[model samples]
Target: MKTFRLMSQIHLWLGAAFGVQVMLWLISGLAMVLIPIESIRGEHLRSDEPTPAIDWADRALPLAEIIDGQSLTVLSARTGMLADTPVWRLETPAGPVMVDAIAGQSLTPVSEALATQIALSRQIGLGEIVSVTSLDSPPREAGLSVPAWRIEFAAGETTPPTTFYINSRTGELRAVRTAAWRIYDIFWGIHIMDWSSRENFNSWWIKVTSIIAILFGLTGVYLTVHRLWMMARRRKAERLGGGGS
Candidate 1:
């Protein structure tokens, strides 16, 4: 009985303190489920055009010349298209960079025209270009650490507005965001209790809430079983008393 009372107290306090949090979880989880995962990935908006092949073996410049006297310590390198041009994409301690494979010139900080072209040629969907703008800091939606070119596109009435982020320097496709994706992202952020940076699931707030949630679950289970047991005992006693009468 004492244990039952303690369980009741814990359950009530848990509901008082964290019921709202649990409700938010339910709402967000439902929202996420209602929105298809493919939509979140912006699959419908992705460009149907196949990517252009790189001219790597023959015409493209050699690795040494691409690095040359820049004193660059090439940590990683690969060949890919930059706009219509073949280029060497590199990862350095400083940051990621790109070089024209044939011309052997740096393509870092590609011009706005090039960024727009990149968005046009390699973008994922049939979106008409809406606006091309630069951001000093990446938007939370982009999920990037570097500044980027924000390209807005207007799709048909059936589809929501979509934005693509291209690395301002490397011109790499960074992330895709649409109305559904953005809403889903918000719900996801709330679901994880990391409204500030939706990507972080390991925050101290989450840890504390997790402990609270576990306690709530355990106490609620105990309270429920105890109630059922008491009801059963009451019915048994009533039957015995009636039989004696």
Candidate 2:
């Protein structure tokens, strides 16, 4: 009985000591689960040069120039070919670009297309969520088809998430947005870090909080069991009339 009482006291004290932190953890966890931190923080609208007027040949050279210093390379170039619609395709080291086969005019700045893809992949608002991945690889078996260019690459064991689509002809970024994006953004913020995509789950703060929560729950269980056992024994004694004193 004394041991049970002691355990009860200890449990109470432990819970009281960590009560605030436990509440915070629950709130934070719920927020992490329900909202996308990315959406909550919101994304900054990037202002870039508007659409341009130029042909595929002129645009391709400059686009190649922009990616030149980078890891981009020209993979294939087929002229006078078109999609179901009249569109020309230019393959690059990074990805393929579709251009208006007939226009001889540049559709959009290469920098702008790349920039918009990068920007949309981020969570910008209080409940927004964005996912980004490099599509500089070959196609996978998923049903991912792009009119111009669709970035298809596998990150982790996850399927190739289409991060962005480009106006192959115009070099413009066209990303789809949804109402549920905010919830995903919040979840992303909770899961990821701000500065870089480094390992955030192994941090000391998370460790400490986890340990405290575990202790708190264990102590609560112990106290509840002790109380239930004591009540049962007391009832037994009453039924026995104090052991037939």
Candidate 3:
């Protein structure tokens, strides 16, 4: 009986203190699992164009000529397309630098016309071009670097807006954002209790709440088992008393 009373007190207090947060955790977890991550990221709206093949027949400019007067410390180099033009992309210590594959001319700070062409070519099911803004600083979305282009699509009543971020220097597609992504981000922020960054799962508040929730579950289990044992003993006692009487 004393043990049962102790368990009851613990269960009641813990539930009262952390019940709302526990409910939020369960609801947010269910939402994240139910919705496919790909849909949330708007991958369905991605361009279906096949990757352009590199032409080996075209004579590429000599590497020495491309880096003659530059003091760049190259990290890596690869071949890719920028607005349908083949180019050699080099990742240096400073940032990405582009050079025409055949002519070996430098191409940095991609022009607006080329950025628009690249964005439109990679996006599907988008309305007419709404706006293109160059960002020199990181936006709210995570994992994006500076010197990027934000291309936004018009929104309809039923269809929400879609935005694409492209690396202005390398012309690489960085990220895709849509209305669904924003919804997911909101719930994720609440779940992690890190509204500012939305990525810190190791916050002190979350750790404390999680510990309390665990204690609540343990006390509830103890109460359930104790109640069941007591009921069974009571039934046996009544049966024996009736027989002896």
Q: Best-fitting candidate, measured by lDDT? A: 1
Instruction: Give per-residue CA lDDT, model 2, range 73-182, as digits (tens).
Output: 65765543222223334566546665444543433233344434433443122122233333443132211343335433223232212333444434444542333443
Clashes of 2: 31
Residue pair clashes in candidate 1: 45-124, 45-125, 46-124, 46-125, 47-124, 47-125
Rank all candidate structures by their TM-score, best first, as comma-separated numbers: 3, 1, 2
Residue 46, candidate 3: Cα error in Å is 2.1
Worst 10 residues of 2 by lDDT: 153-162
Candidate 1 regions with alpha-carbon error over 4 angstroms: 1-10, 48-56, 69-71, 124-127, 221-245
Candidate 1 has an lDDT of: 0.81
lDDT of 3 by residue, 1-245 (tens): 88888889999999998988878888888888787998888777776434545563257776666666356877777777776777777888888898877777777787777778888888767777799998888587825766888888876444468888888787777788987888888889888988888989899988998899899999999998888999999999999999999
lDDT of 1 by residue, 1-245 (tens): 78888788888998877888889999999999986798797866766433547445688778887876345687888777877888888888887788888888887877789889988876554558889999889877886778889999888566677888888878877777887887888899999989877878899878988888899999988888888998999999999999999
| Model 3 regions more than 4 Å off | 1-3, 33-35, 48-52, 56-59, 156-159
TM-score of each: 0.80, 0.39, 0.83
RMSD of each: 3.3, 12.9, 2.9
Comparing 1 and 3 on lDDT, the stronger one: 1
Worst 10 residues of 1 by lDDT: 48-57
Task: Score candidate 2 by lDDT.
Answer: 0.46
